[model samples]
Target: MDDQHTPADTPESEERSALRRVAGLSTDLTDVAEVEYRKLRLERVVLVGVWTSGTAEEAESSLAELAALAETAGAEVRDGVVQRRRKPDPATYIGSGKAEELRELVVAAEADTVVCDGELSPSQLVHLEDVVGVKVVDRTALILDIFAQHAKTREGKAQVALAQMRYMLPRLRGWGQSMSRQMGGGGGGGMATRGPGETKIETDRRQINQRMAKLRREIAELATGREVKREERRRRQVLSVALAGYTNAGKSSLLNQLTGAGVLVWNALFATLDTTVRRAETPSGRTYTVADTVGFVRHLPHHLVEAFRSTIDEVADAHLVLHVVDGTHPDPAAQLDAVRKVLREVGAGGVTEVVVVNKADAADPAVVARLLDEEPGSIAVSARTGQGIDELRALVDRLLPHPEVEVEAMVPYTEGGLVARAHQEGGVLAEEHTAQGTRLTARVSPELASALRAYPDYEGSAST
Candidate 1:
């Protein structure tokens, strides 16, 4: 009955219906049998999206990216469709006609899964499954699945679980046989396909709520420990710089260049899920810590931001932010916006940012030139080549907090600590060891320079 030359009750359609019927639990299985029934692999998927305003090219690219995400999560994308509309249809995402077309396409393609390009409400998901006669997932769930795959650290795993639980909270079913067991079905009679959740959807909801609370409490305890470490760094007066950029940008690469810290460098998105901090001394001998945190992507999930807030605080508290960019990405400007938007959302908007255009070796000179034109004063460097590193060091030196006053200082024998402090903390230009103490010519902070004047045995003059 559809334009695709497919009948409404074709053999393929009937097969799909059969699959879903078996996917649901039957009323004649034992608990052990029911457990076996729950573990089914999702079938091949077909993607559907609506392009409202953008050009066809953009819509196609978005759909392609969705397909890649699906494949990453173990779903094979068999076919895709994009329809133009004023906006997404509220009821079915695509209109009824398109939904029918999708069902026929799913049958013809033998696709067992349907994934929408945008976030779908619970009602939308249910309706799509009904129309397409297969399991349905939206963009949000697909993203969550990917996060679940990439999460490696304990905190990362916990955060992913929290996000997934929150996402599933609203979609909990109410009247299913799965809920009936919780209502005290003893299962002594003809309970063929009986399973644990036959009566307790409410209990399941309550348990999930309890687990969500426990997860938050655990995360909070971990955050307190993280805060303690941050405070220790603050007390040491070590300047903090955070590396922030779009996912797949060369942030980890640059971090290794700066401090010789061998953080994992990968070509995949979200490669660095945990925050790593390393110590580095600036050209002026000022010690600072640089942190590499997770990268940002466009339309990043709001729950992810909330869950990762403790980790994101690295950027929020940093004295300076290194905004790395991939000079080779075709849309570097849009990538920059994505990074900045996430920073702003995380309350790191006002941090002083230094644009670092990395991976210059692979980037076209024209692309690099255009980037500099757009973001004047950005550092252009290739971590592999060690190019422009000295210039970068000089820039960090100039940006960091410097002494207000410059002076020459001489100290007593007992003030060796102050002498060493002058050389390490202060930017000592010249120094000599003497019987009295280390006589030094340095550009030091006024406080330390003033301390030197208090010693009569020390002979030093503050610069006018």
Candidate 2:
């Protein structure tokens, strides 16, 4: 009976029974500078948030999302707390009082880091860490860490590194020698400590700038290659579609379902960073290219947006944009707004957009119905179960822009390649084979129309 009454078995402590067990992310860096700007082992984290305005539920939801981000970074979440206040305290974010309370929670839970729900100023981060006596990471830093971990391609890695450099430029913290106030003269730590302290900071800043310039140059060079490929697609007159959405909203899953691209799909945030482009054919035999790009989150850092501008251009340059939203999320509308905000920033606001509410199988039926009603022309689909996929395919086919030029021509059996080109690059309105040649009527690009006119051996053809 007494054993049952112990602190570990108390109702208040039951929630700490390890729900998830994964290898903890190791935060060991080569130097203190690396520690400041490089990886952090957020192996165990305590989430803290300041509730300024929104209702209790909204605040809780925000914190819940933060918890998810931490877990994605390989952290074990032990506890989370929200403090009610007019606004985040200037010095410590959650106020010094709350920071102390958070310290208690961290110590009790044996957490090594405290993750805040909102981005913190450098001073706030330092002050809060001083009070809490543990590493403090804000929302922006946490998201950046996740991106750093998940980025796949060379360009993606460079972009993430540039963003990390941008983020750390203003918030660089120093240790021991770097923090020394050594001066050659008078009272300021005389001979022993009279070394290059401020010089160290300047040196670090210079190195960072040099590295950032190199990364920008490399990224620009890479962007050129991507643009050339896009131009090639355009030269062929293939319609392009880009998938944009909230992270974990099943965009990759839908892409796989649509084109069988077999792109890796994970249930983690920012799982897909590099843009993947694949060619797909509509049921009506119309061919269009589709790209599955990186996902967005609420309050995504501007540094990231600036760094990933070239990648985001995939959406801006696309002929159609599929904005995917997770149907099962508590606030589907919020996710929609967040993604739309990023799209607008990327100059994709003028592009044709189709809302795709995904994960319908796991989402509440009533919620799905309500969301579909709110979103006129939106399609609800379950990529896992293949529900509404046919309707979605048909809808996409109907919405895709059709070639304006219509032509009818007869080609020799030897020119079978042109006949195939008509079928692949344009919409085949009518086709008939006669002994003379195969007569074809199709709505195709001007380039294809010109090719038909150039052939002298082919029979009479007309374009309208």
Candidate 3:
């Protein structure tokens, strides 16, 4: 968690500050709820969820997360309610009886919106909204709105826009009979149009499909640039570590703390959408890359996963994954499960992972102890306080993969570039000065080994 700062006067700072209004600030437990809702611009919302599975505590936590998401989207959560059920009612999600109950709560709470904890079908959304007499938003829509507001980069904005369009495509609604009319120029509008003509909903869907196709092509082009950079790093034999975890798990803060990357850190969920890569060094000065990617959430919108597939590959391709868990969150175990679920979905389930229990200073001692016990070898560290960071860095160095090829060579001083590459791309096992040049023995990539082998006079033993 990071403290809120006053905005500066520059254009860049102004943009960052405008977003700050939507990003919630970290606050004490007593006033944490108030901190998130203070800037709400009359978007009062009543939260509703159906507890189908899991314990009562998990149900409560899920709704709590929904409230946090609502607040993050600039909505005030007036009240929350959960209905017990074997499964969600197909028609209205929470059923007619509970819908009425929710209506009463919304009316009493003076909320103008009803936010559901699950993704509602188009019909369910309409029925529930009609019964509740307010604008109803499901979890998927709420998350998409947040992404739209927080995305800063061109790629990020394109991804979010594509996702929102996908979600809205099937839910295109039309008013009574007005949108059911035939097109005016239907006489020459072809076979189907010559009959009843194209309806308003049909026209809207066609336009949306066209727009979606264009967006897909744009996103693909942007992803190509990202792939090029990733491939370049691979050619250099640089190891990459990606941060993967639940939203607001203090990943950005941890990244800044470790490498002084200066990324913006916020206390809000899904605050960072664009992937940020920073150069990092281990205890022995071995160079590797650490990336702060978008955070995961329970039931994250499927459209988002599809739209951000290119970005999510950062984790799948990483040499190591730092699975950061918010030690202070009420249900850390559930958070862990949620993150790993998405990891598996992205084909990153088998990647080497290091569980990092963050916010140790704020987390309850018992909670931290239990997490550490459950996740053996997990490290408890506070980005805010710099606790246990040295140990964590050393551990990362030991766990990361090293170069496979080893060699010993003495080269002329003109090849000092090779020495630097040896230190950066691989490990320097030994080094000594010599009259001829520098004698070195180290583990290196096969490509680097080939380069080093070019020197005939300074040749030495080579092994896999």
Candidate 4:
């Protein structure tokens, strides 16, 4: 968690002051206190991380992402530091000496908050805040804050609130006399006073629990409504495809290009929280519904995942998943792994995936070529410029599951509606009007084939 800071005058402080001189700070030192209390925004933040694995470049890339997240949340990143460690320190996240160095850095930079790249335990959160004398926030909380800011719909707001409450419940802290409350204070005046003091924490916990219960009920009600819609689509025999990938990876752009959905598209992270479904047809005239869902990130909060289960269920139930990746990103491989991890967590791992490297227009062609070489079947496309879109559509058409039953039926004019229904729901290879009624050859679902069983077969030889 990131928080405020006070100036210090030590050797480490002097060292940080020298480092700051070379880096050249952007925000004024006097404005730090004023910026800390600004509502609806977090300004002047310092980033810190422990590099446990990977090479130096990977560590730098991760911190760069953290800086971008902070900026997206309306914070100005002053300075970022990564400490080399085998693992994160248990009490303060970074080692004690490094924590002291960080405190100096915060003071030298006049940052109001320190954002960590990973989630911190309750003890670590408290310890770090005390050492740095500022607000401390982990990656999970920052992401949740962004979600809360972007959530617009009722269900989206409910999920964000539920996730925030769950994250806050465990990290609740008390000060002053609140910590002295009695666990059981049911008695006359004197004893009751002690009881109220002891039950203070319990009361807070109870209130949070109640709110959580209410939010869960609301979310379940909303999910039931969505399920009804999904069931309706299933009954119509329309294949469903879901678009999923890292946040800001152009999933929405692709959806708009494919279906003309005109969904709100912004370059910011988690710009669209609610799911958007649009009907689209493949090149072969096969109809399907494509749904764009919330994107994934590394170390996505578990509570957030649980809260959005219903929205993500679209991916699990989909016939195909378009795993879109931003080809211009510095670390596409890591982004792919993060997205795959969330998909598996949501039980969508077994679904067939078509890797689509989007944004080819802005990406380095050499890098795109290397990625395509590595992933033999993956396709590269520019959603904005419409490059390779037709090829993508053709691929999707080819990969979609075809109907199993193929037969020719001759129905009398009195049952002409059956022939029309077949034309709508199935792949009609050929159709002709005959003296009897209508002669039609189509590839259709088993249920539709059964319904048409009573119709007389065409006497002509049937084509496969």
Q: Which candidate would rank higher by lDDT, 1 or 2?
A: 2
What TM-score does candidate 1 reach? Answer: 0.80
Backbone clash tally for model 1? 19
Per-residue lDDT of model 3, residues 1-464, tens digit only: 87666554456654422201112221123456675546545488888888878776677778889988988887767778776677888999987867887888789878899888899999999999999999999999999999999999999999999999999999989997748767556466765556566788888899999999999999999999999999999888788999989999999999998899999998999989999999999887789999999999999988998898899899999999999999999889989999899888889899999999999999999999999999987999999899988998998999999888987777679999998888888899988887877788889999988887665343444432
C-alpha lDDT of candidate 2 relative to the true structure: 0.84
lDDT of 1 by residue, 360-441 (tens): 8889999998898889778899877888778888888777666666666667678887777665566777777777677777
lDDT of 4 at 427: 80
The predicted structure with the larger TM-score, 1 or 3, is: 3
TM-score per prediction, in order, is 0.80, 0.86, 0.89, 0.87
Q: Each prediction's Cα lDDT score?
A: 0.77, 0.84, 0.86, 0.85
Model 3 ranges with Cα > 4 A deviation: 1-40, 176-178, 184-193, 456-464
lDDT of 2 by residue, 192-294 (tens): 7565444567668889999999999999999999999989988887788899999999999999998999999888888889999998888887788889989
**Models sorted by TM-score, best on top:** 3, 4, 2, 1
Question: Which candidate should be chosen as best, given TM-score against the real structure?
Answer: 3
Clashes in each model (backbone N, CA, C under 3 Å)?
Answer: 19, 0, 0, 16
| Candidate 2 lDDT for residue 140 | 94
